[model samples]
Target: MSRWRRLWSVPLLVLTLCVAGCAITVPSDPQGTLDRARGGELRAGASASGELVTVDGSDVGGSLAGIVEEFADSIDAKVVWTVGSEEDLVDGLEGGDLDLAIGGMTDATPWSQSVGVTRGYAGVPGARGPVVVLLPMGENAWQAAIEAYLDREVTR
Candidate 1:
């Protein structure tokens, strides 16, 4: 193999091994939120600070919006959007009124300390910065499923 390819493999291997070493234990309930989301609704919050989360006619158009739509499609859930200020959205997520919060959240964003943040994704256009979604701060099965989907959809 080329030297460049060989060099990349070690770090990739280490990362894979590290990820494999840690496992999340999902509860065994089939009717839990994670499982129910398969054909249920996803309550989501978004700040009306930018185009990334909007009430633009009939569509919510933005990088994070796209991610939300994709997540909803994956689990057969429809996004129930609540547009408001960042504080309001974050409050909603904390209060169990929102399953996901989408905005221009990024690495080093203050929300990371207050809420559960997904791994940042840099691929999407119109992201003010590397974007991460907010979930409640816990290891619930629902958050795990959404994080897994984002690891594939955004990180990949």
Candidate 2:
């Protein structure tokens, strides 16, 4: 190739490579949980945990509940809550029956093996330590959405 042609091709190739590298890719969700819940119901499991999570019959409420509700609303989804024990909530998460779980779970939760936990946020009312929300395992996009919401709304 001619020297001029070779020099122009090299710069074009570098520019192409840089643009490709800088392109944004959506995070993956192995189960398509985020995609499904975007305009539909967000299945959420809740356990009774003091002021962090409260259960009254079929109704779920509390500080964490409010956050979950807001998160759902942000996605144009509604929360369909299932109130249960922690073990049941974990099972729900593992089985993909639930998109996320909340029950005043802390950073030190023992169910980390079966589900994904959000980053702990301190300053939660009535929480003894940093509070976390449980999510379906390997759902990166869903987890990222929730984490971003929490990061914006929750107090450090």
In terms of TM-score, how similar is model 2 to the real structure? Answer: 0.84
- Candidate 2 per-residue lDDT, tens place, 41-152, comes to 9999999999989899999998889889999999999999998999999999999899999987899999998899999988667778899999999899999999999889
- Model 1 lDDT tens row, 69-126: 8989988998888877778888987777777787777776798777778777776666
Task: Highest TM-score: give the candidate number.
Answer: 2
How many backbone clashes are present in model 2? Answer: 0
Alpha-carbon RMSD of each model: 10.6, 2.5
Query: Stretches of candidate 2 above 4 Å error?
Result: 1-26
Q: What's each prediction's clash count?
A: 0, 0
- Give the worst 10-residue stretch by lDDT in candidate 1: 24-33
